[model samples]
Target: MMDKMILKRLMNDHKNIAILLDVLAKKNHKLSEGEAVNFALIRDVVEYMQVYAEHSHHPLEDITYDYFVKKFSSPCNQQLHEEHSSLAESSGALMYSLNLILSDVVISREKLISDLKAYVEMQKAHMQYEESELFPLFAKQLETDDWDKIKLQCEQRLVDDPLFSDTGDNIFEDLKEHIEAG
Candidate 1:
């Protein structure tokens, strides 16, 4: 079984990502309505998705997936594994497209918004699959020793997440304010 602390941390990451997606969706709606969007806030939100969600969160899940696959020999989780890889690329592309738009370059706003929605949907689906399918599988199959090893591996793979970290980089201030206000 996955350790309680590890499971809680991963679940919290999913929650945080969900909050950011809602923030991004709200920004997209404002843009669609021809209202002024806070580009800086959008940028910060994208950066968090790229840095913390894609970079840190996905890889940790990948570790869990890897361990699960090693022990269980089930192919059912393959799609979720593939989604993890694709999400990183999708998030990177979204960030790049957002940067171009912010630089006064004319990219199709519709396409960018479409991509953002797609990414958010895919991420949410991925998390749901993990919570429903993968986590339960891990809990049933993995033993205490297995979790100990996975925990050590996850700790070694951990990155200091700026959005969740104590260091107050003010870029996330707007995003935090938006989350609280909503």
Candidate 2:
């Protein structure tokens, strides 16, 4: 039951992430076209993603992947775990770049646009890997007890996806409204 619930949330979270990615891609295009884009909004997206990924999504995945590896006597993909930290760093750098511009620091629009494109692509590819590889592996190999264990482990570290939750972190209210309004 918990496994299924976590799986459902993970899939839904990916969809939400995709929407943010599209927003970034579109904003990047606008920036490239010499249009003024909202730097704070871009920063909001990155900040919220880092918060959710670090606090909720990645930990849930770690529990699930840990159980899978334990049961099957096979190693989880190194990238699956390493990508969390790597993406965090990447998102942090992107936010830093946005912060610099927001502070009136001169930055190259083309460089920022390129970074945004790369960031969005990286996120999409990461989601695709989990959906295509790890998810199916769990469905096929993990036992009922494994699911229950993974579920219990998840409960121990549960954190709501702030952007989607009614009682989410207060900092994300504006970003939530923007996503809902979009």
Q: Which candidate number would show the highest lDDT if scored against the true structure?
A: 2
Tell me the TM-score of model 2. 0.91
lDDT per residue (tens digit) for residues 55-140 in model 1: 77777888877877777776654686688788878878888887887899988878877897888788888888989987877777
Worst 10 residues of 2 by lDDT: 1-10
Off by over 4 Å in 2: 1-3
lDDT of model number 2: 0.83
Tens digits of lDDT, candidate 2, 74-162 = 85568888888778888988999999999999988878988888888889889999999988877778767677777888886677777
Give candidates' CA RMSD values in order: 2.3, 1.7
